[model samples]
Target chain A: MSAIATPLAREPVLSLRGVNKRFGAVQALTDVHIDVAAGEVVALVGDNGAGKSTLVKVIAGVYQPDSGDIRFSGINVTVGGPGEAQALGIATVFQDLALCDNLDVVANLFLGREDLAGGLLNEVKMEKEAWRLLRTLSAKIPSVRIPIAALSGGQRQTVAIARSLVGDPKVVMLDEPTAALGVAQTAEVLNMIERLREHGLGVILISHNMADVQAVADRIVVLRLGRNAAEFRVEEATTDQLVAAITGASDNVVAARAERRRTDGAEAQLEEGNSDG
Target chain B: MADTEQTHTVADDLADERLIRVQGLSGLVHMTWNRLRSGELGSLPVVVGLVVISILFYAMEPRFLSSRSLVSITQFAAPIGIIALGIVLVLLLGQIDLSVGSVSGLAAAGMAVLVVRHGYSELVGIMAALTVGLLIGAVYAVLHNRLGVPSFVFSLAGLLGFQGLLLYVLGRQGTINLPSGSFLVEFTRFKFVTGLTSYVLVLAVVAVFLATQLWGIRTRTRAGLSAPGQGAVLIKVGLLAVGLLVLTWYVNLDRGWSYLWLFFVFLVVVMDLLLRRTRWGRHVFAVGGNEEAARRSGVKVGRIYFTVFASCSMLAAVGGLLAAGLQTSVSQASGTTDTNLTAIAAAVIGGTSLFGGRGSAYSAMLGIIVLQAIQSGLNMVGVDSSVRFMVTGGVLLLAVAIDSVSRRARSSSGRG
Candidate 1:
C-alpha cells in the first residue's frame, strides 16, 4: 500500500511521468506517461519502433531514461540493472523469453535465485515450488522436469510468465508474449494475464495484436512514434480508435481499406436499386 | 466453481491426462526408447563405441584385453583424461581452449625447472605451475571480456606462445627429470589402492550412490511426485557394484589400479557434482546454451566465462604435472604435437557436444578410455604411430559427425 498522499485519488502500484529515452541521434521515447494499479492490466499497443519496447526496457532496468520520474508504490527509486529491477519487485518477460532451452522448466524458473540446502541445490523443494507456481497460473506443462526445448511455444510462454512470479513482484511486464504464438497459445497467454491480474499484480502487456489487447487489458495505452497517442478503457475503446491511435493517423491503411469497402457497398446498393426500377 | 475444483484436483496429481505417464521399469525402458528416437542420445553412442572397440581389439590381439595392457591403458589415460576434463568445461561453454596442451607443457616445464633447476620443493613447484594456469586463464578472460577477442583466436595465440615458453623455461637442458624420491613421482608412477582397500572403496561408492537414490525417492514421494521404484534403485546399484568389483578384480591381476587413475576418477566425480549440483554449474550450462539469454536472465556471463577458462587451464596444468610425474621427466616434447587435439577428441568422443551446453565430466572419463584403448590396441597389432594418428583422427571425425547429426535430429524432434 502507498503511504504518501499524492495528487491522484488512489496511488498506482507503478507510475511513470514524462519519461524520455534517447539512443544517440534517435529519440526512442519521449514524454511517455503510464500508470498501472494493482489488479489492472494495461496493454501497451504500438507499431514497430513506436517506443513500446524502449519503455519496457527502461522499467526493466535494461536502459536508463534520460528524463522523467518512476514511482513504485509512491516511493521514487532507481533500478540500476535487471537484478535491481527484480529486487524492486518489477519483473519483466522480454520478447525472447530469455530461457535456457537446454535447462528444465524448474531450472529456468529458479535460474538465478536457486534454493539451496546444505550448499547443494534442493531439487525436491524446487520441483515442488515449480508445481505450485504453474498450478497458480493454470499452466498445462506436462512435467516440470522436461527441458524447455521440448515444450510448445504456449508452454514456453507459460514458463516465462511463471518465472516472473517467482520473485513475487508487484508489477509484471510482458513484451509481445503472443507475437510468435499460435491462436490457442495466444488465448492461453491472455488467460494467464487475467490470472496475473486476479492475483492483484499490476501488469504491463506490450503487444501489437488488437484482439489480444482488447481481450485481456483493463485499459489500453497507445504509443505512436515514441509518444503517447491516446488512452482508453477497454470497455469503451473500439478497434478503430485503438488502431488510429497506434497508426497515429485516421487515414492509415486499415482505415482506408474499411472506408473503401463502405463506399463500394453503397455503390452496389445504388446499382441494385436502379436495376430494379 | 465445479470446473475450478476439478482443475484443482488435476493439479494435485501434478500431471494432466494429456501427459504421457511412465511407471515402473517398463515405463523407464519405453521412455528411453522414445528419447533415443527423438535423438536425445546422451552417452549411448559413446558407450556402444567403447564396447565395440573392446570387442574388436580383443579379437585382433588377445593381449590387448590382458590385465597388464588394461592397467597400462588406465595409467596412460589418466593424465590426458584429466586435461580432457578441463576441455569438457570449455566445450560445455561451446568454446575451445586451443592452448590447453601448451598450457600443460608450459606448466609442467615451469614446475620441473622450479623443482630441479631452481632447487624449489616439489610442492612449491606444483603450486607455482597451477598458479601459472590460473593467471593465464585470467589474462585470457581480460582479452575476451574487455577487448572482445574471441576465445579461439586468443587461445590459438596462446598455443604457440606457451609452447615457446615451455621450451624457453627448459632452457639449455631441454629436459628435467623429476627426482625419484619425490612424492609427485611416487604418486603418479608407483602408488595404488590395492587388495582389501580397493574393494572397500568400491563398496563406499555403491553405498553412497544407494543412499542418495533412496534419499531422492523419499523426498520425491513425500512431495507427492512420482518416485523411481525401490526395485529400480537396487537394480542400478547392484549393476554398478558388480561392474566395479569385476573391474577391480581384473586390475588387481596386474600391478593393481594406479592411484593416479583413482585421482583422475576422483576429479571427474567431483567435477560432475560441481557441474550438476551447484549454482555455478547451472550458470555455466546456461551461458553455454544461450549467452544472450543467460545475460538477460542476469547471469554474470563474463564471470562464468572467466571461471570456465580458469578452471580449464588449471585442469590442464594438473594434467601436465601428472604427465611429468608419470614419465619421471619433463622435456621440450611434452604436451606438444597431438596433445591438444587428443584432449579435445577425448571430450567429443565421450559424447560431449561440440556445440556446448550438452556435456558432463564423465565424458572425459569415457572418451579418454576409448582413445587410450585404441592406442594400446594399435600398438599390440604392430601398427606404427602414423597409423595410430590417422585412426584417431578418423574416430574424432566420426564423433563430431554423430554430434552434428544428433543435434539436427533433436531440433527437428522439438527437443533441441
Candidate 2:
C-alpha cells in the first residue's frame, strides 16, 4: 500500500528522468522525474504556472527538454515532434481536444490516420472501428455518424479520448480533460480513464481538480514552481496536504486564515473562563 | 459475432432516443426536416431556386423552356461552369481567387498565340497554357503559404496584372484565332455523344449509382449498423435515372449531348469523388472548418492550401481552353467580360458556402446551369447587360444571406 513499495515493483512503460526545460529567462521545469507504469493512472497535479503543462508539452514533443532521459518500454528515445511521438506509441490528447467540428465523430476519430481500402476512405471500416472503440470505452453517444458540433462537452471529450486510442499507443496523456466538463461529464471522463487503465495503457492525467485526481488516480504527483514538491498515494493524500504542496508552504493564505480563526476562538473562550472563575 | 450482438438490442445509430426513426420515404423526410432545422440545408435551396427561376422565365417567354434553348444553356454553361468548379474548391477553404478570370484569359491568349504565331501543335499550346496556369498557382501558393499573404489581396492584384499580361501576349493584334480544324476546336465546337453514345452514358451512370448504393447498404448491414432502407435507395436511383433520361432526351432534340458539356460534367464528377472520398478532401474541409484544429491534428495545412490554389488555377485554365475552342478565337476581352463574377457567383449560387468547409463540386454544375439559364432567358426577353448584372447581383446577395442565416441557425441549434 505504500507509494514507493508498489511503484518500483512494475517495469514502467513510459519513464522520464532528470527532465529539465527552460524558456530563455524562465526555468519551466527542473529535475522532473515521472514514471507511468502499464495499467496505472498517475495524476500530475499543480497550481497555475507550476511546470505541469511544461512537463506534458515536453513529453508530447511540442517542446523538447534541454536534457532528459525518456524511455518508452525501457528503450531510450527522443521525441522530435508530435508526429514522431505518435509514431513512437505516445498519444497526447491536448486540452483543446483538436477536433474538427464540421466532421463526424468517425471522421474525427480517424482523421489523419484514415483507413483506406482501395486508396479511398473506407467509411464502413472506419465506422466499425469507431463503434468498437466507443464500445470499449462504453461511451454514451447517439451516433458516430453525427457531426461533432452536435455533441455535448462530455461526448466530445469521449470522442477526443477515443481518437487518441485509434493509434494503439503504449502511453496516453490527457491534459486537463475535465477542466471544461460538467459534473456528469467529468464522471464520464474519469470513468474513461479507468477504462484506459483496464485496457493496459499507461496514463498521465494532468489536472487541477483535486477531487477528480483523488477519485481516479493511483498516485498523485504535485509540482510547485518548477520542481516536484511532493508525491502521495491516492489512499493517503488529503486536500490539505495537496493544497499545501501545490502552494509550497503550509502557512500560506488559506492556512493562515484558518490559524487566525482558531486563535481568536481560543482567546474568546479563555476570557469567558476567567470571568466565570 | 452473433454473441456480440446479443448484448445490444439496437444498432449504434438507433440507440439514441433523441432520433425519431422511421422507414422508407417518411424516414428521409424526417431526416431532411431535422437537418434543415439544424442548418444542414445542403443543396435543397439551390435546387428550388433553379426550379423557381425556370418557372418564372417560362412564364415570361414562351420559348424559354424549348429544347433548343435548353441545349444552348447546357452548352454555354460548360466553360464558366468549369471555372466555377475551381471556385467551389477555393470557396470550400473559405478563400477566394479573384484572378480566375484574368488567369483564364491569359491562358487562352497564351495558347492561341503559341498555336497561331509559333506554329506549335494545338496540344503543345494547350500543355504550355496549362503549365502557365500551374506556375501562376504555385506563385500564389508560395506568396500565401510562406509570406502569409491573404489570397484575396494577391488574387486581386493578379486580376489587374494578368489582364495586362494577356494584353501583352496578344501584342498589338488584340486577338488570335485558333486554327479551325484543330483538335481543340473540333472537340469543343462540334462534337457530341449522339444517339447510342448518349443513351449508353445515361444508362451507365444510373447503373453505377445503383451499384454504389447497394454496396453501401450491404456494408452497413454487415457492420450491424442502421442502414438506409432498400425502398429509399430505389427511390433515389429511380429519380436520378429519370432526370438523366429527361435531360438526354431534350439535348438529343437539339444537338445531342455536347462533348464540352460532357467533359465539364466528367470533371465535376471526378472532383466530387476527390472531395468526398479522399484524405486530401477531408483535410481540406478540416482546414476550412478550423485551421488551428487541423494543424494541431497533424494535417499539413500549408500543403493543403498549396494544392487547393494550384488545382483552382489549373481548372480555370481548362475552362479558358474550352472557351477558346468554343469561340474559335481568343481576344484581349477573353476572360474579361463577366467571367470572374459569373464563375464565383455560380459557386455561391449553387450552395457552396463563402464561409468554407461546406460545399461540393456538383454545386458548380448546378450553379452554372442556373446562371446560364437566367442569362439565356433574360436574353430572350430582351434585357440589357446592365439589367442582367443587377439580377445576378441580387441573386448572389440572396444566396449569401441564406448561408449566413443558416449558419446562425446551425450554431444556435448546436450543429455549427
Runs in model 2 deviating more than 4 A are: A1-7, A257-277, B1-9
User: What lDDT is reached at residue A12 by model 1?
Assistant: 93
Q: Which ten residues in a row have the lowest lDDT in candidate 1 chain A?
A: A1-10
Q: What does fnat come to for each candidate?
A: 0.67, 0.68
Candidate 2: tens digits of C-alpha lDDT, residues A1-277: 1134245679999999999999999999999898889999999998899999899988989999999899999999999999999999899999999999889998899988888889899998898889889988988887788789989999999999999999999899999999999998999999999999999999999998989999999888888888888888888887878888888788798788878999999999999999999
Kindly list the per-residue Cα lDDT of model 1 for residues B314-398, writing each as its tens digit: 9999999999999999999999858898999999999998888999999999999999999989999999999999999989999
Question: Candidate 2: lDDT over CA atoms?
Answer: 0.90
DockQ of 1: 0.64
TM per candidate: 0.96, 0.95
After TM-score superposition, the amount by which residue B30's alpha carbon in candidate 2 deviates from its true location, in angstroms, is 2.5
